[model samples]
Target chain A: MVLIYIDHSEKEIKKSSHEAISYGAAIAKQLGCSAEALLLGTVNDDLTTLGKLGASKVHQLNNESLNNFDAKVHASLIATTASNLNAEVIVFAHNINGKAIAPSVAVKLDAGIVTGACSLPSLQNGFEVTKTVFSGKAFASIKIETPKKVIAINQNSFGIQNYDSSATIEEMNLPIPTASVKVTNVNKIIGEIPLTEANLVVSGGRGLKGPENWGILLDLAKALGAATACSRPVSDSDWRPHHEHVGQTGIQIAPNLYIAIGISGAIQHLAGVNRSKTIVVINKDPEAPFFKAADYGVVGDAFEVVPAFTAAILKMKHNE
Target chain B: MNILVCISKTPDTTAKIAFTEGNTKFDENGVQWIINPYDEWYSLVRAIEIKEKDPTTNIHLITVGGPEAEPIIRKALALGGDEAIRVNSNSNDSYVIAQQIAAIAKQGAYDLIMTGKETIDYNSACIGSMLSAILDLPYVSLANHLEVNGNTATIQREIEGGEETNEVILPMIISCQKGMAEQRIPNMRGIMAARTKPLKVVDPVATNAHTSIKEFSLPPAKTGVKLIAPDQMEELVKLLKEEAKVI
Candidate 1:
């Protein structure tokens, strides 16, 4: 059996979790096993809706304590659930929660685990999975020697498919462990699209000069219904909050449309946003490294180009 | 205060990535190695910061690699680590590395353990969390700031839209990131002093690697960019809407 961990935050199921389900389902099809899902806490999303994403069965741990993410508890409980099902493969979205918990789960089950996996396992002779490495500069195929395997699929790597199968939700009665660290607060920046969930992202860098000049980027983001992000240097210089930074050492995001405005793509910066489906780089310097990775490039001053781009998007939205 | 810092040796950011032997092994012939940026800039620096605040604090650097990784570890020591430990092994498997780290950390009884959020090489990001599990200690990943007072530690980590401040008791693990501390360059004095720092090389306790490499390949090189003039912004929007379907 293939077990997928359904990621959730604040009562809503995450978008990347659905992509993981599809990836797991495809793997299950290859391995001739059943694809199932395990969800912690109760989510507002209808459990049966998971069938569209290819989950045949959904096992939910409905305890209130499981609502808030505690990696230790989540890993232990998820490992137990996977063991209970005798799952040959456990899949997770290589997002915040999955990256935290998957390794612990792997250690518990003594399973060979792969994170940032970009493809399905080749099961002809043995279980070999391909994963991104060297900060997305390369890919390596790794064989899982262990019978059980855990895979954390990178977001946007696998497209979700509608399988048209009904999924039955079952409640599990596993003992929940006490959280190790207490969460003093969960402070969310209200009324902004979250970078993780945003399919469209508009990010800026130091080239914007100062925080005072952020209006153009925000306007572009607002016009596009996209989340805003910044390069690590901008965050380091306090031009943007640390949470807004997206890079190798920051929040790794894989939005569908990543509009990088005035941001020269450092390797660390590219590592985070390289997974996006379509990258749009607008920088004054034509030699900026980001243009090479972008599907579309516009070399111009942000002061001139941003307003025009934002106005164009607003006009298009108005036409719709 | 005893703090253990974990380090990883990775190819420099500008190193040319290549594969060899029908893609079975990485072509390391021309690659230049350095301390993984996050380890140097965040993990080790943060440990140094804590040690500077309280002069009695001891910061030890540890790396799970062969002798080739010693230079990186020594570099870390020069940056402010009191000493260094090199576990004699070269396994890319994260679980095996974590087991070794857990065993060593248990024996040391360090008050805090730190490592980069993820190495720039494999980017598995599971070692620190796995170490926390094996040792049954609390862990904070991608932490921007950390403060310790006696047995209590207050950590601030980035969440989806904002940050969360968590309070945990000591003997915890933190996978450090950018904001933990600024990167420090080793001064001439420190570099000279590092030659005298203790670097104990030890054999790893027997561990099994659960994964093996089948092959390696570089990602397809990026195609040249499609340039669009600033006046053509409307065309770009049209393309995104009708062609890319992302607008």
Candidate 2:
């Protein structure tokens, strides 16, 4: 059976988890097995809604302790669950949680595993999985030669297919190990959408001159209802928070639409956003490296172009 | 305190990716190798932080690769590790790599195991998790902040939509990511110290798994941009509604 780990935070389904379900469902279809889900923590949404994403069953641990993630405890708990359910294949979104838990799950099960899988497995002969290599620069087909397998599917790599199937929500009586660490305090930046979940991202760079002018990018992001990002230099220089940085040295993202303003794409910078589906670059230099990577390019002053772009979007919304 | 950090050698970001004859293998010609960026930022840095926090701590670094990877392992040693171990194999599968590391880790009895959230080369952040399972240790991935106090560790991990804070006992595995630690540059002293560090090369243990790389390919080039005049807001809106279809 295909088991998918549903990653959520404080009651909201992660967009990436939906993609993982789609991927898990496809694998289940290919393997002629049922697709089941394992959720950690408390999510307020109706668990049955996962049926639309292709889960045949949803195994919920649902304890308050599970709400705060403890990787070691989580790995042990999941390993126990997987073994109990006799799971043949386990799936996770190649996002943060997947990266943490999937490998541990593989080791616990003594199973062969692949992470950042971009495509479905080719199961005609054996279980061959296709995954992105070289920082989204290429692809390689890997065959997992083990009785059981683990896969972490990348976000936006597989499209979620809507299916009309009902999934049963079952409560599992798994033991929750005591947490060894205590959270002293949490400093969360409110109001800003996490970059991974944002469909549209407005990013800036050194060309913004300083943090004072970051408002232009923020304005554009607000106008487009998007998240804001920055190149490594901007983050390193403290023009933006480190979490807002997207580059080889920062968070690699694959959003649907990424708008880069005033940033010249360095090789390191491109490594992060290269997987974005549609990239829009706004710069004064027509020959900037970012233009080569952008799906859309505008050669003009970001100071002038960004506001106009935001105004244009607002104006169009008003007209509508 | 004892720490283990996993590393992988990956192609440089600028390499033109291609497949070999009949798409059977990755075309490695003309490709330059570097330490996987994520591993460098997350795993390596976190290990260094532990070492720096406690002067008596021993940081051991390991990689599952062939003889050609010795220089990279040495470089990692230069970066701050006290010793190095290289499993003599070329296994690209995460499971195999985890098995190799787990074997070494079990023998060394390290208190903490760390790896990158995902290697930038394959972007597969699965090794740490797999190793945790193999070793029967708790595993946490994408830990941006980690602090060890006595026998426990407080880790802040990035979740799908937000962050989740947790505390776990040590002797567990952690996959590091952004904000774990600042990147470190190898100074002259570090470079010299790395050359003198002990690097043990061991043959990979035999395994029944016969995982193989069947083929390789490149993603299709992105389509050209649909340019809209600066003043054509209606046309742009129409395109977003119809052609682009992202509205």
Candidate 3:
């Protein structure tokens, strides 16, 4: 059986987990096996909804203590589950939590693992998986030689399908590892859209000049319901918070649509965001390197183009 | 208190990437090396903060690289680490590096272990998480901010579509990113003190490497920029309409 780790926050299921379940189900179909889901910790959301995404069964721990991620504890829990269910392949969404736990589980199971996987494994001759190498610069096809395999699918790499099927939600009773780590306090950064999960992202650079002008970038982001990002300079200058920085020196993100305004595409910055499905460059300078990487380019002042773009999107949404 | 920060010596951010000998190895003829920027921003800065909060606390910088990496190691020492360790190995495999680190971290009795979210060169981002499991410690990645009091650590992680605040106790592992703290340049006194700091050289312990890098190569360069006359805005629109089809 193919088992997927379903990650959740609060009671709402993460969107990327839906894609992971869909991808895992497809992989299971290709392997001539059934797809099941294993969710760790407590979930406030309805677990049964995962069935609509192709999971035949959902194995939920339903333990509140498991909600907070402790990698060793999770690795132990998942390793135990994999053994109990006789799972052949384990899958996770290559989000932050997945990144923390998957490789450790792979080591615990002695399974050959691949992270940042961008597609379904090519199962023609053997199980060959294609993953992004060199920080989204290249692709490599690797064949796992181990008996059990682990793969972490990059978010937005596979499309989520809402198939009309119901999955049986079963509570799995397993020994929960004692939490060695103590919970202190949860300091939440409440408002920003998670970049990895955002379908649309509007980012800026030094072209915005300073923090006061960040309102336009935020305006465009709000207009499209997109996450906000910046080049290293903007963050370095404190025009935007460092968490908003996306580049070789900052966060690496792969969204469906990335709109870069007034930013020159430095190779460092490109290394972090080149995986976006569509890139839109709005810069006044026609020669900015970002225009070369962009699918669409608007050679106009960002100060003018962004507000106009915001208006245009609002108008289009209103038309709907 | 003792803290261990694993740092990687990577190519300077702007160095042009090339390969040598049938693309099997990175061409090191002209590449400049530096303290991997993420490590500087996250590991070193946080280490300095911890040292400042307690003068008796000692921060140790560790890396698995050759003698050529000493300058960058010195740079890290100058960044406020109380001491340094250079493991005598150039193994690039994530598992091998993690094993080397886990060995030292186990013996050092470090109260905390920290690193950057990922190294720019390999971009594996796996060693710390993997090492956390090997050592049986709590691990947090992409920590934008971290606050430690006693044995507990509270961190805010930037997840895919949202932010998650987790509180894990130390002897934990943390991989930090931008929001952790600002990168600090070494002052003159710190630079002078780094020369007098103790740096120990140790041979690597046995390790099991599962993956081997067969070759290295740069990505193909993009075609030169395509330009349309400003008056030809409609032409640009036409290309987007028919060719790019991004509209």
- Identify the candidate with maximal DockQ: 1
TM-score of 2: 0.92
Give the alpha carbon lDDT tens digit for every residue of B1-247 in model 1: 9999999999987777787889887789989999999899998998998988999999988899999998899898889999988999998899889987887898797999999989998889989878877887878788889999999999988676777888888888888887788878999888999999999998998989999988888877667677889889999999888877886
Residues A90-158 of candidate 2 have per-residue lDDT tens digits of 998887666767777777787777787888898787888988777777788888888998888888879
* Per-residue C-alpha lDDT of model 2 across residues B1-247, encoded as one tens digit per residue: 9988888887776766777799876678998888776778668878887878799899988999998888788878888889999999997766677779889999987889888777666676667766766776776677898889998888887654456676777788887878888777778998998888899999998765536777778778776665655555456556655665665
For model 1, what fraction of the real interface contacts is kept? 0.75
Q: Which pairs of residues clash in candidate 1, taking residues 3 or more apart in a chain or in different chains?
A: none
- Give stretches of model 1 more than 4 Å off: none
Give the number of the best model, judged by lDDT.
1
Cα deviation of A37 in candidate 2 (Å)? Answer: 2.3
Q: Note the residue pairs that clash in candidate 3.
A: A194-B161, A194-B162, A197-B160
List chain B TM-scores, each candidate: 0.97, 0.95, 0.94
**DockQ of candidates 1 onward, in order?**
0.72, 0.54, 0.36
Which runs in model 2 stand beyond 4 Å of their true positions?
A180-184, B160-164
